[model samples]
Target chain A: MNKDRPDRTPESEERRAVLGKMASATFAGLMLSGVLAHAQDAAPQKTLIPARPFKVSSDANQDVLIRMQGELERAMQKPINERRWGMVIDMRKCIGCHSCTVGCVMENKLPPGVVYRPVIDEEKGTYPNVTRTFLPRPCMHCEDPPCTPACPVGATYKRADGIVVVDYDVCIGCRYCLTACPYQARTFDFGEHWTDNAAKGADGALALTAARAYQNPPNFEYGKHWERGEGIIPKSPVGNARKCTFCTHRLDQGMLPMCVSTCVGRATFFGDLNDPKSLVSELAGAPNASVLKPEAGTHPNVYYLN
Target chain B: MTRNTKILWALWIILALMGGIGIFERLTMGERLAAYTSYVPWGMWVAAYIYFIGLSAGAFLLSSLVYVFGVHKLERIAKLALFVAAITLVMSLLTIWFDLGHMERNYEVFTRPQFHSMMAWMVWLYSAYFALLLGELYYALRRDVKNLSPREIQEDDRKLKRLATIGIPLAIAFHGGVGALFGTVSSRPFWHSSIYPIMFLVGALLSGGALMTFIVSVIWPEKDEAWLDLLQFLGKIVLGFLLFDLLLEWAEYSIPLWYGVGPEADLVKFVLFGPFWYVHWIVHILFGVAIPVYLLTWKRDARSIGIASALVAVTFFAIRLNLVIPGLVTPELRGLEHAYVDPIGNRLSYHYIPSFFEWQVLMGVVALGLALFYFGQRYLPLMQTLNNREVSK
Candidate 1:
């Protein structure tokens, strides 16, 4: 045995690993405590303000609710640091045939009553000089999403990757998000299916692959849910809050969402928005493109080219 | 079991039948019953959600008179208010769930909290408010049990007291936060007003107080003490909230009209006077505000109070609708296709109608609330007025 070498006992190795973990945890905790303590010390000091002449503050000042809710406004100003997922729709190019709506339905397999996409037809001008325009709509996935705040459980969130997603299992069936959404872009899966009869091969068609479902899936680095029939079984039914995920299941396989792939006009494009080299980047920079419902402050992902 | 039971049952049955229609529209026609399309994703369900939200806020405000104001004479009605608040919250949530396309992934609220999202604030606010209500309820009950011997108390008095105390401040936080849910939106002109939260709070108090008069009368408190005082207290609360709500509305309404509002802001105006004018007229002004004010505070007998309350329950849900739906229906741009969103951020939910299955689920939730109220009132120590059954003229 080399004199420089320490003991070869298994217990020492175990102890070393344990010590290493403890050191890392302690470091993290110390850093966290320092941050919290600093924040506490830096709490905003209250300042006196002039009272309104006629307005009665009453107990209804709502200072508490407002103070507690400051985080939301803070979020509104959180600054889209990373390539904030955005979209550009060219209003001039839309042909109102309901192709996007039809394609979305065929791709997403939404229950009847629920349309993942739609062609909004607008009649402009009056009398003989009237003109009509069709605007296709999808979730804006707002930078300051109204829907996200309404969720009681915080089941939905925006990913660093720039997509808004919902975690199905934890949703308590409260649809606050539905009401909170100003875009009216969301849908509720009211627990209804193709049919209520559960036993009659009632697996309900998996829209991921159609043909009732897909099979013989390959493992992808992301979402790994390659097989349509072999995807991870979520504890939710079709009736839960379901919306578009930009085909994350497909994105994992280096593919685009079904709707994007099948767009008859090749109107939709998909890619990592952060990389300036990406096609969406070039399109976003192009002056002819615009996004739907940009006024809602929900930075959407779907762009349109006129 | 009795004729009274039969009457309540009939009311329930009628309610169920109405809800059944919503369910049918939801399941069969999908976006058929209502014109909810992806371009206009929300419809009746969003309106219903807002309505229930008003009711919940109103109910909570009513409960606060007894809790925060130290008016324990109004105490007997407080628990019922709390229960009603809980029930209406469930109804509001059910409405939203039925409106979403991927109601399946509605989980994101809990798993993901968007600090910036007004929707997220609502989720947290409601949760915290629920907690607060539960806390105050326990506190209200705690002293009663404490004064009595250990044998006379229920199983978990200590924990109950702790929880109830926690709920007191939470109720205020909850409704205010709910107001902020809409107020935080800079896009929709109607919702963008800073006074919206204040409007919501006053509206809650107004509706809650109005509801209490009716609920108190229905129970037919034959021998309860301070019946007169309770009625008087409720009148004041209702009048206060109503005036406040009206003033806020005046400010909210005139501001946009005065300004050369953008296309989105004009949409709110459209909702108020255009296709949705009826809702503004019948639901918001007449049924929600004016009718209840007249019924609750008018020089009338106890029966009028009950009817007024039942009406308040009806109209408060309506007021919530006025708040939620109108803002949403207004297009984000001058012209856009999708009006609503589904759970997974899909544009499809904008066109949802409550299916029959959705209605069944909603009915199930409502039934559950009713059952809870019935059983809680019957078996639990819900009311101090239980022993005194008569409301003297």
Candidate 2:
């Protein structure tokens, strides 16, 4: 054997491959940390500007809700069409905490059969090296929504300001739109209460009272206060297909979407995409930004950052 | 009453009682008792609705052959077919109306319908068809409606034939429109095919013809030599439609699955080999197609053909189930089936099994149909017409 090369075995080659993968993964982690650091640095300066006449100077380094709330107020002053509302969700920052889901439920007074936003948890790889990923899904509100045309009753449609809405009063509850959706974002209202069966058992009366109070409150969805109840002709949502509207009624009051304000990771961004200086515009215009199911040709306004 | 009649009455009473409970639940509780959720909205009722509608279309078309095309051999049963068609049409409308979120708002289709939807078009076409069907049935029964003399009988026949002529187009349009309703849904990859409408038409012919054959053989008042001849002809026609329907089904299933690709491929495989694979293999192919085809071809008699046709009629519901459920069972997005879980409400998950309450409602609809048929047989001169024919001979 030539002594020039010392101990170059097949085992060494296997080790080399494993080492290479580890190096790449570490480099990727470092790159993500850099991006997060940059985001933190840029946030405070944007928050310092006086967004409204009655508002005091908000610290740029304040919570993401305050920054986004300011952005929402500025966008509301523009004409509706000139305001192309969009959302940007950064996948890297999401903690899978489900705060957004809970916040949405509370804000909408969601009944048992209805859910406006849900956190999807996906686990990748197999054993020890496995990592978990969380994707919180809301309605895409597509520019060319497949759901709208599929509705025989013309109950659901896309607004000029880029929010898709369902007219509960007009909806016949045919559920054709539910099947048409590629994202599976829509759910039907089956007119159930959380404390339905509890009312028949021990300590059930108190639970029932709490449920009725929580459930019957006026939910300002689509700018109308809806007191959901069970009747011969139940209200709009009770017999209709429902989905996320980006909290349109809240937007009318110059507030950010419930999900955007409630995200624990501050991963969600919301503002008019038309406004070049808006936080959502900057994030959505980034190269990493992408939409779900691009092959579907839905042209969704919701963008995701990896 | 004979043994068969006694058994039928017993069945009707039991079903009616059960169905009453379902009706009560539907009236008081609304859609809360049903197993189908927002994810899988349509269930057994929607399938039953299409099944009854298809049967009505098929029976009406068979009647058209005798009245419009002047098939003298099938003339004796022409009135019978029209009556069966009308009953089935009523049942279909009732089932679908019950399926509606707001049954009272069904009149909205007539008032505020948007023409772009195939559903709207289907409803309109069927309403027209329903009108034509009533008109045709009335004319067919004109001899019994009045104490008509022989000359008047001839006049009634002319009116009946004219009404049947108008009914031919109405039947075709409404039935084919039902197919188009499913076919035009481009979002549903499983249903969005040109052949769906055609498949529905052929299926209607097979199932409807078989049902009529069963009814005629078992219930015909005259078991004379002519009755045997009538049964033989009806049996042959049913066999022909069944074979044609099978051919269309082959084209429907095979073409989509040939390459083992496309969104439809997995869904078709699920129908053929999934958890409910028996619905297609055992219920549809074995009982509906194979056994019936064998009996018709080999037995070549009224009794055998009647039994075979009845089997085909009952098993044909499996085909309708396969068409409706599988189209909706699969989640449009991957992982959606597991995204949200609702164990009690049954509205969150994509997986669907029709609740027992749903079955009860269906039973009620069937009992209603049977009761209607029973009353029609007793009060109407349906059986007397055959005695008159014998007397004339």
Candidate 3:
């Protein structure tokens, strides 16, 4: 009834029409936003980077990984013995993410109890001024590895390229090498599978199927495809003493160790120590560089930059 | 069968059943059934191996007193001691063999031996000791064999005595070498000690002699004046060895703990006050040393001495457990135990307690040893001498 005075007026009619349009648009905008938020929540958040052929980047201040990859290619051209492989970890830059650990497991198909890389967490100072420190430990690959000489069967020996390799066929699995290590870096494989003790129902069967696929095709470790399975005389790595080989197979194929490439903080460096210009050699020569248990006389190839 | 024989058979069958499960688990599951992980790779089995080996060495050395040095009172028990050594040696080897990751690959120790490793050297020396044991036992048994003539019988005893003379140093080397195997691991401060080899040697003598004494007292059959004299002499030797072993233990512990500092001190503290404190305090100290020492010293009756020796032999395994576990419990690096964990498999953890399966395997090993001893006693002329050729004629 109040609108009757302006009912016939064109301006009033136009205003009413404008208000009606605005209300519907507001509701539709809110509903669309709700649907979009839900869609984002369901999607996988991890960024997938596709594998590509090695290429030296021409960009200024190239990524550490690209530079290291180029360095690795150059090192491989030299004689095997001449390339003394070394790793340098920068402690200050680490944020304690265990991506390297996961990557190593996936790359090596590591079973339970067998770990190539572990990040140690340390808390310093009193409650009010506390700061947490992360130290990612990989095998030191010592110049004088205590584990090699202790093998009664001489199954484990240092490679000409400075990597310590365990010959699965020769190793008696006496675990003397496991005991001899000063770092306690070596682990004995107890021949365990991940999907152990799962329920026999439908969901469990699905989970097991997925998990079993994860372990299949056997990991290409030590330049050989090792089908690690349980038996009387079990396959290599099932009964054999295992440790970090610095992804030697990957290195052979012009790739960095899984850990070095997986670190989010870009904290780890690997290269030929014999090359003075290499990043690892430069970082290892830094004043702050140090090794674990120097008094042990292991002369470890891994160095940490504080 | 006597009531005692029936009881032993029952005990053995139960052990066999339990041991069968353990062996079956080990074969089927590999190391999955074991509580020991990569963190503590060695476990109760390794401890048992050294314990049984020590007993073998100690018993062999005691036998030498009668055969090599001609101790007249101990002469009657020399063959018995040798038999005990042979059985216990088998038990030790079996324990170690089961403990191997690849039990089949143990032959590699001989074929592709790394002489630089103390383990290889220990294996080699013990193999020689095993050969010597067989030779000595054969010579002694040859005298009793109905096939042998009078001249051959006399020659057998002479050769047995000479073989015993050669075995004295061999026993010392092998037992001492077992100790050295643990001592030379510089990474483990608890095991790395100059006194370890000496301690192992003395421990062998005590445990071995005590077992021999206990067995002789229980089964000598005659229980006459000669038996009493033999028991008394053997008891005195055991008591001496026990005192010496205690002295070595004191040196090993007190010196490290005096400072309340250093890696050895920390490890010793952990052993003295850690989770398995009762293993050292109760099993080893109170039962093994205190009660047995009291029996040996105050109670001088043959039965009491035999009981004391039995206590020493049984509880000595606790000492072996302490030696092996403590060396491994303390982590080489801080935060290592928490760094990564295996929930399904026990091996990732630094903490270790022998699982039921491990105990079962040990029980089986013991049952097998007892069975072997029973068979040897029934078959071999271990107790009675061969028909004296001159007296029989």
Highest TM-score model number = 3
- Please write out the lDDT profile of model 1 over residues A1-306, one tens digit for every residue: 654567857787778766665665567668675443333233232432224312322121233222212222232234445444444445666666677676566555554445555667888899999998767666666666666655556667777756677665555544556555655566655433323332345444434334323212222213632221101222242334556666666544434455554555545555545646445567877887666557656666667776
Cα lDDT, model 1, residue B273: 76
State which candidate, 1 or 3, has the greater TM-score. Answer: 3
TM-score of each: 0.64, 0.87, 0.90
After superposing candidate 1, which stretches have Cα over 4 Å from the reference? Answer: A1-306, B1-6, B9-64, B72-117, B135-139, B142-166, B223-226, B258-271, B291-301, B333-368, B381-393
**Candidate 3, DockQ score (0 to 1):** 0.47
Give the CA lDDT, 0 to 100, for residue B143 in model 3: 66
- Candidates 1 and 2 compared by lDDT, better number: 2
Candidates ranked by DockQ, best first? 3, 2, 1
lDDT of 2 by residue, B186-267 (tens): 6678888898778888888888999999998988888999889989999999999999989988888999899999889999
Question: Model 2 segments beyond 4 Å from truth?
Answer: A1-71, A199-203, B147-163, B383-393
Candidate 3 per-residue C-alpha lDDT over A29-75 given as tens digits, one digit per residue, 9 for 90 to 100? 57675443333223222323324537553111346776688789889
Scanning candidate 1 chain A in windows of ten residues, the lowest lDDT window is A225-234
lDDT score for candidate 3 against the true structure: 0.86
Write one digit per residue (lDDT tens) for candidate 1, span B227-326: 7667666665666677677888777777667774766447557657776688778877787667767876675455555565567656666566566666
Q: In what order do the candidates fall by TM-score, top score first?
A: 3, 2, 1
Q: What overall lDDT goes with each candidate model?
A: 0.57, 0.82, 0.86
DockQ of 1: 0.12
